[model samples]
Target chain A: MQELMGLYTKKEVYKRFDEMNLMELLTNSLKVQMKHIHIENNQTLLSVNDNKKVYFILKGIVAAQKDDELLYFRGKNHFIGLESILFNEESELTMTSIGRVEVIEFSKAEIVEFLMGLQEGWLYCYLISKDLNHLLVRNYFNFQAKPYERSKIMLNDLAKEFGESSDEHVLLPKKFTLAILTNYLGISYVTMRKILETLRNENFIVRSDKQKEICIHTKLF
Target chain B: MQELMGLYTKKEVYKRFDEMNLMELLTNSLKVQMKHIHIENNQTLLSVNDNKKVYFILKGIVAAQKDDELLYFRGKNHFIGLESILFNEESELTMTSIGRVEVIEFSKAEIVEFLMGLQEGWLYCYLISKDLNHLLVRNYFNFQAKPYERSKIMLNDLAKEFGESSDEHVLLPKKFTLAILTNYLGISYVTMRKILETLRNENFIVRSDKQKEICIHTKLF
Candidate 1:
């Protein structure tokens, strides 16, 4: 529970509720059941076959995948498995832990009941819809852009979001393999590998000896 | 008011409200003020420069456009200028009337007040959010598919939604011109025209010169 508080605080999840006047409703609706689980570097936390449940990442990193390809990574404070829960459908994408991770799970029945009881549940739903819409639009634009251009845009977004000012770089787990990059860019795996190699040789990114993680070398370029 | 009744039978709107479970709330929220305006073909109904107000199409066809390129043709029961109204932002798209049109306008202030007053307003908001998300996904998928393939998908959706069982044809207004189709498919104007011609020659669709409309030749092949 203490660890859960730290992760949620870092993620600003409850702050977001206050911004939308949904803190009370969300708190009352959610009964936090915390769990600790050890996941291998590439093991799935949740998959298409799993039942719908909302998961809040308490620690470590989890990457979303589709068709055996990595799509995106969610770190502490982020929530995943929302689409399946919202539509009451099977998960369309898989969530895999890039490293050992912990998460809090909320059942769909409790969520539905919570929403029904809340005065601001409708507002929360509307906000989620808006966020999903934005994601789709961003994906569309990314798909339309050239492969290298798309990669650059994604890297820039990540740099801005997760980059530490002192380091000017961010470490991404090896779980974000070439297959994941290709799936996200909607390009061929071969092309993605070639591009990664080119970027590495140019010093735009540095891959460790283990080749399981990457560090952006901002000053090199 | 009587003519307005013809545009959307109170029964039809009520049916939609029931499906959404907003019957009582919608009825209480809406303050009906009907207006009639003669709109010449291809004349602007709402421009990108216009003030933010949501309008419900009561009669005739209205086309939404961006940068002079037609995007969508909306008919009865469809709402326009909603994006601007909801976001309190300037219109990002222009809306034009394809023919003589009648609509009911609701100011954003009034609508917001009404929404806040209703207990189920959040439900309506959630539904709208869900709808916007769906539209974004549809647009993303459309852009991913080939131009011709995109047209086929659009035709199939239209047929399924509006086709007459006996005739096996779906009639669409001239407002759905080539420019609109191109915008919807996110393809070039020349490509959209070429695909339209190909479909026409292949007898996949038939154009009515007298009525100035297109009819699907059959269900999806």
Candidate 2:
């Protein structure tokens, strides 16, 4: 895998609004009808066919899955169920809290009205759309890869999206478990364990003490 | 595949602007600098990493490819290279005309300015974004499917998007040749031929008389 081609969805253009002080805009928009939601560990945030609301993550991680297959993970500043609003369709992925998750929630109508009030609001929708497009492109190539390469690509994406990087390695958050990895790869627990075991023996990955979090070696990318 | 779950990206919400008379609005926005471009069959419309303009297809079809891999196809009313405008990144796919194609083109700057001028313009961007989001969701599941299932889903999607349906069959446009189908499956020519032969024997698919087009039996979906 190419380091520069690492699947980091956010680009410089996505952060363009930061210079314009998005916090102020978000603060103003907060006056609209919205809710502060707190979900317990393992709680469901959104389910397939639910399309009434959107949630912007404030803290902790959320895992998105379709049926039993894990699709991906999202963290702080990511919007959950935005696809419901964008496509005006039922939520395709079932999102759940990995740990305790905090989010600011908005009804579809409220958010749509708020977005209509701003000239640059389309840019926000455009940015989220770009994120999905990037994933599509990544997965397009990923599906064609062999098992080891597919596992490596998924881990590399996770490391880039949610890991804390150091000179030697990238440390994934504690909430990312082996079970979640297995789910993402859509393989049996035993099969995924063997794959991980092989990768570990080769020094491509390391699990921290207590097996809570995984450390991905930088050279894997 | 469930008939309702047939991968049609456009929904009732996407058609909302149609009732609002988008043509008049587009005509009004036509004052902005735009070009009418016509390209012959097999001509390149947008190359990978060249991101400057957006094209709205007025006639014929386009095939989007990443390197040598076929990503998907787009037809009339679809916009090409919009990802460049949305993400402000270099184009990821090389778009080529499948046949003699006509499109209305806009520079990145002009379209941005035009979209900013209307309050409802964000909805336009939102709709296009929704189209992409739909494709992402579709591809997410598609990547995990087996080869035959993947091929069926692609044909079903193409049937719905660009085909003319009768009571018994969905006739795809002439531009969708065997080569394109083979490219889409990412299989060797021999393998794709075998798959087609099997599907044909099973009465799931039928090639047109001239073999320039394909007809999908409605029962396949």
lDDT of 1 by residue, B1-221 (tens): 12222455545534443322432344455463324445567777667566556666667777655656444456666666554324354555578886678776666545555655554443344445455455555555554466787787776665554344446666655556665555666677788678877877877777656533567766543
Q: List TM-scores for all candidates, in order.
A: 0.67, 0.79
Cα RMSDs, all models:
8.5, 7.2
lDDT of 1 by residue, A6-89 (tens): 355423543544323432344544363334455557677677677556666666777665555455567766556554323354
lDDT of 2: 0.69
Off by over 4 Å in 1: A1-32, A36-51, A59-75, A81-101, A144-151, A158-174, A190-221, B1-51, B59-75, B81-102, B146-148, B158-166, B171-173, B189-215
Residue A154, candidate 1: C-alpha displacement in angstroms: 4.0
lDDT of each: 0.57, 0.69
Best by lDDT: 2
Mind giving the per-residue lDDT tens digits that candidate 2 earns over B107-177? Answer: 76566556656645556665666666667667667766666777778878988888888988998887777
Q: Which structure among the candidates has the greatest TM-score?
A: 2
